[model samples]
Target chain A: MKRNPLVPIVVAAIIAVMLFAGIHSARKNRAARSPSVSGQVHGKDAPDFELQSLEGKNIKLSDFRGKAVLLNFWATWCGPCKIEMPWFVELQKEYGPQGFQIVGVAMDDSSTEDITKFVREMGINYPVLLGKEEVGQSYGGVNALPTSFFIDRDGKLVAREFGLQSRSVFVDHIKEALNQGQPVQAQK
Target chain B: MKRLFLCSLVLLAAAALGQDAPTMKPVVSMAPAPLTTITQGKASQVPLAFRVIRGYHINSNQPKSEFLIPTALKIGATTDIIIGGTDYPEGHDMSFAFAPDEKLNVYTGDFQVDVSVRPLRSVLPGKYMLRGNLKYQACDNAACYPPKQLPVSFEVKIAKAAPAPRKNPAQSPHSHK
Candidate 1:
């Protein structure tokens, strides 16, 4: 059988394009499969960002460099978020001086005034920041409410939780991060 | 020729077996109750009710807070209704075997969610729509089904407020009945 040389070249080009597309899509799928912050965050450097708190204070990630920080993303409209707000407040009060800090980034479309009012009503002790959608995307777009990240004293991302988490689960990660010097990386 | 005959026989048996399989269809049912609209002073007492079909549970406003499925509700722009928190009736939680050692949370049987709407001011007499979407991942005892977004729309009729009672018509301080 005689084969055309041009046919082979064209077939090779098609195969190459398909392979490239497949690889690109696979990478995107892998990124999407990475455990979202709502469930767990035992590994991965906590992506950091700076935003103004509801109190009109400049809050930065490096500001809490020497302390273990709990970064919680929540919204006023989310029922679970409201349910978990008090737990974060209690944690801040219990561990504030012992190198512990809770930072709440509210993902809400409402004005800062509304979020501040909600925080006041909830009596949250931790600093609450106004989370913008673009800013939230940098740390993995929060598909759900009550997503949280735990950073250790060494400024390493240690753990993540995707949904409403119990206080004990959060405290355990905080303790581990505080005790360990190295950052925990999320498994691929 | 014998080999070809055997292949034809096997294909016929397979087709017969396939016909014995039961067909399945997506099950969805929704119903809205009365009392959709209320007057200004009577807004706090109004209720918005729904009934879902058997063998399905709609995701409440909260669905683990990890998935992208968001429960949505829309009200008329002109209505000054204050929607209260959604209340989900408790149901038995069933487990599913997603993997060899993984389990998921789900609800089975009938459930109800109550929506309360309060009118801040007198509403112009007209018809309105209340729409809501429940995003849920349904599963039976063994296998989890694909996630579904069930949309429900209900109509409401707002009417003018009734006249108030006379200030001291019946309860006069000096009146003796």
Candidate 2:
């Protein structure tokens, strides 16, 4: 018996449609699971991690509980990182006394000596800690240098800045986090 | 009807082939064999496909940002073989926290790099292993880590060409001379 001449083309179309639907749904599911936190949102909890500090001490995110945290992921070789380091130092100085802390996670492969030298040269006054691949993964995977996550006193991820944002942007986010501070007694 | 049946068969074969492609391992690794064979004395194309660990991506041959290190492939120098220019796949566009809003060209998952490998006519017949490396800076959505070079060892098997047909001295055009 002879089959329809258009049968193959019709079958191919059906297969293609099915495949497209399957792939699209899979991608949608993945996206729903890890909605890239590319914007500022107040309800999300900041993923906590612990890493070695330059002083050879283990620093955990939970340790900074009840304090507004400005987490900056940077590298010594990043030029834009240098541009923002001094500003970060200044921000830490301005906000440290007010229940605010700046944590610098150096995503570098350089020896401690080199990182230390760069930190000193840049006059980075905040807690400079070493970062690892897993640490980046916890925060939904940071793909760029100088990415910062602003966490309120309650550990809520208030906002995220991917690249080198303006100082005012940093200040504005910090203000939001500070305003979201805990009860007056917790501020002490 | 026969033509339609043939086309359907081809599509099914292609679909199965796609499903059979190997997946990326946890750590960066290279494919076992070149996609195409390398023949001696002739210019043959060899496909070098590197599997980047899942969820992580390396910048394309030309990263958008100057500070980012582009992924590079290099084959070791060998007198027995001549390595020609390489062809890299177009990078997928993805944004990072560092360059918010600006998409960076990168390669994630399994990507193939096609290059020309010419085995010198004089090279002996056997397996020739050439050393190479893929220099890349891996990053996720969160941060970019230090650049790492994954050493690549390419194995090319060369088969000697068939010996020229011998003339019965009587059949040789030069037999008269």
Candidate 3:
């Protein structure tokens, strides 16, 4: 029997193509699985959204264009969110004078009354808006509670943190947000 | 042939690396339930096993705090079968890194829920399917995921009740004589 010299080479070529395709697909999936804030949308303009506040007033993200904003997504059922609410309150007071604003978006299914009660109990000094699914999707899917995004005064997203990070991390991000953007009068 | 072997090795290594990557999403899976057999008009307990992905915990049916969302099972209504109360296992009281001072009642790893099911006496003796949803909210050391409802289903085989003993004649003494 005569053996063909190109038989093995053709087979190897097929396997090589398959392996390359597999690796490329795996890398793409890994990137998709990663959290959006982890280098996916850094330095990009923060997605704007209009949500209803606890006071029944329509609030838009652009309303705080001149102030550095800490957009926090949380829920009543989220234990970690509860743990960080107090820290957020204190930080709000500390940075309010420096044109820094902390805006909370309640992503829970609880009623507005319940969220308001929680805010009152926690002594939340900032505006707490009722979160909508579309709004959350716009911000790259708030998969976990206590997800916070820091936007500069120019409305550019500077940083993002998932889960409950140390208070120092929040402070550092806040300082960076305050320093990066121009200071102007915050709208009511 | 050697090049083919090298390609295979590279593919295996890539798969291993992908598997080792950290997962941010929480997963809760239910094991296949064993079919429960019950006599007509009698009650039987069907145990359903569930496993939460490692490094995450969900609140039990009764959490310590009112604010926390508790896991619950709600069976769908059926015409032939009557769904009774569901019994949940007690959660372990543990503290996480986020809240070191406060202990939360949660269910980690594997847990079981016993559901009470009863078949009506008039129901035909055969297998019936039961379906429901288990609603749970999961959290890890640092973050909490939104509440999700995992679809659940199981089979129940109903058997006919044994016939009652025949009653003796009323005039037993006269009949005997």
Best by TM-score: 3
Cα RMSD to native, each candidate? Answer: 13.5, 12.1, 5.7
Local accuracy of candidate 2 as per-residue lDDT tens digits, B77-157: 889799888889999988766546678798988998876789888988888887888888776554345567888877778
Q: What DockQ score does model 1 reach against the true complex?
A: 0.03
lDDT of 1 by residue, B1-177 (tens): 775576556555444433321112343444555646566545443343444345444344454434323334444334465566555554443332212233223344445556666555555666766666655544332222334556766666666777776685566666665
- TM-score of candidate 1 versus the correct structure, residues matched by position: 0.45
Report the alpha-carbon TM-score of model 3 versus the true structure: 0.82
Interface RMSD of each: 14.3, 8.5, 4.9
TM of each candidate vs. truth: 0.45, 0.51, 0.82
lDDT of 2 at A134: 92
lDDT of 2 by residue, A10-103 (tens): 8778777756665665555433322234353566888888899999999999888888899989987454576678888888989888889999
Question: How many clashes does each candidate structure show, in the order listed?
Answer: 18, 11, 0
Global CA lDDT computed for model 1: 0.60
Q: Which ten residues in a row have the lowest lDDT in candidate 3 chain B?
A: B17-26
Estimate, for each residue in A33-106, the C-alpha lDDT of model 3 and write its tens digit: 43334466668999999999999999999999889999999998898898898998999999999889999999
Residue A14 alpha-carbon offset, candidate 3, angstroms: 23
